[model samples]
Target: MNLILFTVVATIGYATAQSEQYTDRYDSLRIDDVLANKRLTAAYIKCMLEKGKCTAEGRELKSHITEALQNGCSKCTQKQLAGVKKVIKHLINKENAYWVELTDMYDPKKEYRHKYERELKSL
Candidate 1:
């Protein structure tokens, strides 16, 4: 009886530790996604501010990034998804700075709307 109880407790402890590790990894991945998406969105906004019109390219870029983010978070915990959404909303509200950086990165000559698509697909 004592050995059985000890084994069970050890198993539970191992499982709990593994769960915590996975949770931490998921959190780190989510944070990376948030930062990357923000950078991409900021670049798009910058492009629009400079051009006086939101370039179709910029719109497509934003849409693609949003799609990537949504797909990536499909299996994430609700808390993780909520955190990402908050970051997105904050970035969207930074109209001027985001636009400035976006404009600098916008290339009217490139067709890269699918830039992050492959990364999302692999996930």
Candidate 2:
């Protein structure tokens, strides 16, 4: 388990500094409020989460990243899905990983809320 722990720590360390863009507040709104904003890119959101500069939880950051994928991406194949999930697992807390992993099972025909029902309910 030492290697696994080391990998996790290394990943976390790499993500600790995203962009210098974030100031104390954005238009009087907290960082969490702006996370799901349509204008932000997935990369930017991922960086923000990695930096962990704001008070937003790991789950919240993953939610926003998933939301961005939903909005910006077309239907993803299994391979694409796996990559998104891999990123989520590395980015969020282990406790929140299950929920994000469950989200990877998304079907384009189904709504986002319906897709993650089990994970959400369990939480």
Candidate 3:
């Protein structure tokens, strides 16, 4: 019984340590890399920018992109930038599921539909 209990406790401790390492890895990642990835970026933009008001973090992301565009970044590779651009295009484009999801969430607001359309175009 003691051995079984010890084994269970050790397993839990190992799992917690592994999860903490992943959390730390994620926390230290830069915003660009966070938003550049397909799954994270789309989910974040959908929830923060489309469904709800842009959070401070979201605004910071916009600022980051604008700054990068205005004065380029030596650290950012063209491939990384291109990937982000591609994902942004997917988000704002009329053909994607993201557009449909945002529109459905913004239902019953006539102006919101136009606003969503215009926002995508502006971006």
On lDDT, the candidate that comes out on top is 3
Give the per-residue lDDT of model 1 (tens digit) for 70-90.
Answer: 355454456656654554445
Q: Predict model 2's lDDT versus the native.
A: 0.42
Total backbone collisions, model 2: 0
Give me candidate 2's TM-score against the actual structure: 0.23
Residues 1-123 of candidate 3 have per-residue lDDT tens digits of: 999999999999988765532112123336566546776666566554345455455554444443343343222445545544554455666336665554454343443455535644666
Model 1 spans > 4 angstroms off: 1-23, 26-72, 99-123
TM-score of each: 0.28, 0.23, 0.31
For model 2, give the 10-residue run with minimal summed lDDT.
18-27
Relative to the unseen true structure, what is the C-alpha lDDT of residue 61 in candidate 2, on a scale of 0 to 100? 40
Better candidate by lDDT, 1 or 3? 3
For model 3, what is the C-alpha lDDT against the true structure? 0.51
Our tally of clashes for model 1 stands at 7
Measured by TM-score, the strongest candidate is 3
